[model samples]
Target: MSSSPEKFSKNAVIVNELGLHARSAAKIAEIARTAKSKIWVIRDGEKADAASIIDMLALACSKGTRVTISADYSEDIEILNRIKALIQNGFGE
Candidate 1:
């Protein structure tokens, strides 16, 4: 068994028209819950749990905002990548 968990981190821009609002935050949280990793999003030096809609909304991210995401898990990297793509694609708007 591994002694330490694998980690993933990346920066993504909020390109959606509405930014990181309640609905968008819900979408992010929905996807985040599928992974075993603990995911966190950082904006302007403030960090929020990606699995929590309220935490995400508290970041107050607007369109064109840049955010950093970090995940720690023992599973494949697909989860983190998927989240990155979702943010990059503006969560399909």
Candidate 2:
């Protein structure tokens, strides 16, 4: 029997003045796309595909919004951390 892969996640707050807008979402998606497993961004009970810019934008996360960045597999932990850092750093805005 095979067991599910370990999941990795981190929490971060949107610190950018503009929040998670198109550019920031795009940046996240870019990193997410490199993950070997699925990446998810969740906010206020709403989940968005980290690889989908539109899905992220739909979350409408504004400044100070808290979000969870998760990876379906432990192998993608670096991807999770990169995204978390990006959000925590205000997307470098």
Candidate 3:
């Protein structure tokens, strides 16, 4: 893989009232695991593996929580976008 910074990062807020609990975290983790890239989520400057549902849920992302996502590799863009959309759309209820 080209280590030429072929990555994209974004800071976003969690808008879901229920926060990133098990089901929501599962959804995100499932998608992240299928991606051909390394994904991470940062909260309060602490980062965790995005592909791990347990790790994500441990973050306890409540409503209005800010998170920084960083993905290393080209295919990460679409995945990141979907993640952002999920957060924005309230995890589709």
RMSD of every candidate to native, in Å, equals: 3.3, 2.7, 2.4
**Tens digits of per-residue lDDT for model 3, 1-93:** 446432487778888889988888888888788789888888997777889988888788999999887788867888888887887788988
lDDT of 2: 0.88
Over 1-93, each residue of candidate 1 has an lDDT whose tens digit, in order, gives 233332467788999989989988888788889878677888988889899999999999999999987777646367677878998888887
Number of clashing pairs, model 1? 0
lDDT of 1: 0.81
Candidate that scores best on lDDT: 2
TM-score of each: 0.85, 0.91, 0.87
TM-score of 3: 0.87
Error of 1 at 86 (Å): 1.0
Model 2 misses residue 70 by how many Å?
Answer: 0.6
Off-target runs (Cα >4 Å) in candidate 3 are: 1-7
CA displacement after TM-score superposition, residue 60 of candidate 2 (Å):
0.4
Better of 2 and 3 by TM-score: 2
Clashing residue pairs in candidate 2 are none
Q: Estimate every model's Cα lDDT from 0 to 1.
A: 0.81, 0.88, 0.82
